[model samples]
Target chain A: MEKIPILRMGDFLLVTIQVDMHDRLAMALQDDLTQKISETSARGVLIDISSLEIVDSFIGRMLGNIAAMSRVLDAQTVVVGMRPAVAITLVELGMSLPGVRTALNVDAGMELLRESLNGHEGIRHGSNF
Target chain B: MAVISSETIPVTSEPDIVFVRRRVRETAAQIGLSLVDQTKVVTAASELARNTLIYGGGGAMQLESLNGPRLGVRLTFSDNGPGIPDIQLALRDGFTTGSGLGLGLGGTKRLVNEFAIESKVGQGTKIIITRWK
Candidate 1:
C-alpha cells in the first residue's frame, strides 16, 4: 500500500526515509531494497535518514539487514545523515550496527559508496556509533 | 509524582506502535524535555510498544505528563499475555526470547530516568518508565 520511493542514479540507488515507519513498512522496505538491488544490478545504495528522528532496535536491525542483503548481492550500502540524537540512542540501545557502513551526509555517503565500489575493501566510517 | 494529564494508547497492531511513538514524542516535548530527551523517550516507547504487540500479545500504554518534583513524561505498558518468566534474563542484553536484538527492556531502561516492571507468570506484564525534564 504505502512505500518509500527508491530512486536510481546511474549505478546507485538512493533512498531518503522521511516517514516515521511502522514495523511492517520497515520490513517491506528491506524486501523491496533487496529485490531492487538484484534487479537493477546497482553497485551501491545510499540511504538518507536525516529526516528520521528516532531509530529503535527494530529499525536498526532493518538497516543492518538491508546492508547484509545488499552485500550478498554484491552491492554496497552507505547510510548517511543520521541525526546526532539517533546515533546516541542507537549505541545506548546496544546495537552498534556492526558491518553497516555509515557516513556524515549524502555527499559523503556517495563518496563512500564510490570508494567501496572501487575495490577499497573495509571502507567503513571508523565506528558507526 | 502527580500526573497533570494522562491517556492510554492501545497497542494492538503494527501501526499502533508508530502511534505510540508519536504520542510519546508529543508528551515528551510538551513537558519541555530537551530534544535529545524527547528522542530517547520516543525511541524507548517504540521498543516497548513493539514488545507489547509481539510478546505481550497486545497491550496498552498509559501516557502521563507529571508535575510533582519535576516536569516529566511517564509511560506504563501492560499486557495480559504469558508474562516474562525471568525478569533478570529478560533485562539482560543479548538475551532474547523473541526474534529481536534483546535490547528492548534493558536499553529502554537506559533511555529513561526511572524504570519499573511487574509481571506474573500466568498473568501479564506491566512496565512503567519515566523521564524527567
Candidate 2:
C-alpha cells in the first residue's frame, strides 16, 4: 500500500528515494516509472538517493534496470546524491551500475540531463532500437 | 568469546529485508564498528537477507553482538528451502540463479572478517559472517 511518489517537472520526472526501499517497492517504482515515462513522454529522469544510507546489490540492480528501461523509452536517467560510503560499498559489491548516470546533487543531475537531451537529441533519436 | 546480545528476525517478505538491514546497522554501531565498517556489514546483511528471501524462499536471520578479545557483530542467515546445488559455483562472481547481479554470496564474504556456509541439496542453507571492531 505504501508507494514512492513520482513528481514531474516540465519534461522530466524526479524521484527522491528518502526511505530504505524494499524489493517490492523498488519493483513497483520500476513499473510506475516506465508507465509514467510513456504517458508523459518525459525526456529525462533524476533519482536522488541522498537520504538512503544503505544500497546493496539488489537496489543497485534496480537502479541499473531503471536506467536501461528509461533509455528504451527515450529518456535519460541520472542518479544523484549517492553517499560516499554507499559508492564504495557498491563498487565492492561488484555492481557499478554501468549504464546509469550519476551526479553529485540534484542541480548537477538536472544540468547533465538537460545537456544530454539537447545536445545528443538527434543521435539518440536515430539510434533507437 | 561471549555474545552480549542476540536477536532473530524473520525474513518472509520484502519489508523484512529492510528491517533486517536496519537492525544490523544498529547492532553494528552498538558494537563500536567504524562508519565504513558499519556500512560494509550493513550492506553485507542486506545482500544476505535478500538472498534468504528470494533464493532461499524465505528464512530467518540471527544477529549477535560478540565481546571477546575484540568487540564484534555476527550474523547468521538460515533457510529451509531447496539448497544450493554447487556452493563453489554459487560463490563465484557473476553466477546467479536468479535475476540478481550474483554479488550476494561472494560480495558478502568479502565484507566480513569471518565467513562460513553449509548447505545440502533438498535440505537448506546456513551462512554466518562476522565483523570485528
Candidate 3:
C-alpha cells in the first residue's frame, strides 16, 4: 500500500498525499494535515498531490477546508501540481478554493507561500466551516 | 432514444470498487476526454458508488450523452432508508457518522462537472452529477 508522505520544513509543513484522484484517503489526509497546521501554528502549508490520478468533489471540499482552516490558524495553504483531470473535476464539482493559493509545482507553491508570509498585511483569519 | 444510453449496477452488501471504476472510465472515455480526465471521472464515480453501498445501502448509476461536444454522466444513488438530516455536516471532512473514511459525499461532489442533491429525512438521497468531456 502506498503511504502518504509528510515533511516539516521549519515552521512550514509539506505533505505528499498519493491519491487515485478518487479515493477518500485524499480528502482524509488533507483534513488530518489541516488540523496539524492549526495545532502547530505553522506559517505555511504545502500539499503536493502530484501522484493523484483523479480529483473528485470530496477531495476538493477537503482541500478547500484545509485552506480555510489554515487561514483560521493564521497560516497560508498552497495546493500544488494538480493534474488537468483534477482541475476539470474541481470545475465540474462547482468547488472553488477561493482564498487558497495554487501552483504548478512545489517550487512555485513554496515561492507563493514565502511571498504571502513576507508581504505586509498578509495575515487574515476567516472560515466557512 | 438514440442519444440516451443507460446502464444500471445492482448494489450488494459489498460493491465492487474496481468494476464501478471501470464502468465510469469507459463512459468517460466515450466523451472524448483525455486519459487523465477519464481517470478523474472514474475516481469520482468510485467515491459515489462506495457511498451508495455504504451509506445509501444501495443505488444505481446512469450515464447520459449531453448536448455539444462534451459528454456527461449522471449517477443517481437511492436507498429506501434513513436520509441525511444535516447535509452540511455530512459534507464536512471527518464528520462521518459511520465507519470508513468520512470523505464520501464531500469528495464525490468535487469529482464531477455538476452536482445536485435531493434527500428527505427518513427517505433517501438522489445525487445527480454530470461531467463534460
Candidate 4:
C-alpha cells in the first residue's frame, strides 16, 4: 500500500504532495493528517501542492475536509504552491475550496500558519462555511 | 473528425483515475494545447474517471487525438454501473448521490470545449468531452 508521508515540524505538520495522488491517497492523507495533529498537538498544517498538476472537485473537497477537520482539532491549515493553471481550472470547475486557507509558497504558507498560531485568531482566512 | 491516435485505459480502480489524468495531459500537450487547456482537459478527465469508478461501478477511458479541421483531444468515460436516473438534476452543482462535492458532472462540463453525456438506468453511462487546441 502506498502512502503519503506526514512530517512533524516544531509546531506544525507539513505535507508536500509531490505526486499526482489517486483518490484513495488523498483520502488517506486527510485521515492521517487529522490523526497526526491530534497526536502531535500541532498548531498548524501546511500542504504544498506545487507539484500537483490538477485539483478536481474531489481533491478540492478533500482539502476542504482537511481544513475543517484540522480546525476542529485546534490547528490551522494552509495549502500553498498551487499552479496558476490549476487555480484557473479549479475556479472554472466551480470549486473554491471553501474553508481552506492558501498561500503562494511554502515560506509564505509557513508564515501564515505561524500567524494563526501566534494568538492572532483574527487573521484566519478562508471559508465562511 | 479523424483520430490520429487512440488508446483505451481501464478505469476499474482509484489509481486508474490518476493514469487517466496523466494520459489526458500527455495527449493534450502532444496536440499542442496550451498549458491552460491541458490542465482543463486533464482536470475534467479526473472528475469523470472518478465518476466511472464510484458511480458507474468501473469502466474505461478512451482517448482520441483528433485532426479534423483542428487539432484536439477527446476523452470518453464509459461504465456499466447503475446509470444516472436524472441527468439534468445530476448536472446541477451541489447535487450528488454519493459522498462527493457534487461537482463531478457539472464542473467537468465547464472545463472542456465540448461536452456530451448519455446514461441509461440499470444499463450504463458514457461521457465524452473534447478540447480543441
Q: lDDT score of model 2?
A: 0.90
Interface RMSD of each: 1.3, 1.4, 5.4, 1.2
Candidate with maximal DockQ: 4
lDDT of 3 by residue, B83-133 (tens): 789888877654577574445466666656788888788888777777676
Ordered list by DockQ, greatest first: 4, 1, 2, 3
**Tens digits of per-residue lDDT for model 1 on A1-129?**
999999999879999999999988999999999999989878799999999999999889999999999999888899999999999988887889998999999999998887766664445333121
For residue A120, model 3's alpha carbon misses the true position, in angstroms, by: 4.8
| TM-score, structure 4 vs. true | 0.94
lDDT by residue (tens digit), candidate 4, B1-133: 8899999999999878888888888899888999999999998998888889888889999999999899999999999999999999998877788565457478789889899999999999999999998
lDDT scores of the candidates, listed in order: 0.89, 0.90, 0.69, 0.89
Task: Please say which candidate is ahead in DockQ: 3 or 4.
Answer: 4
Q: Which of 1 and 4 is ahead in TM-score?
A: 1
Q: Whose DockQ is higher: candidate 1's or candidate 3's?
A: 1
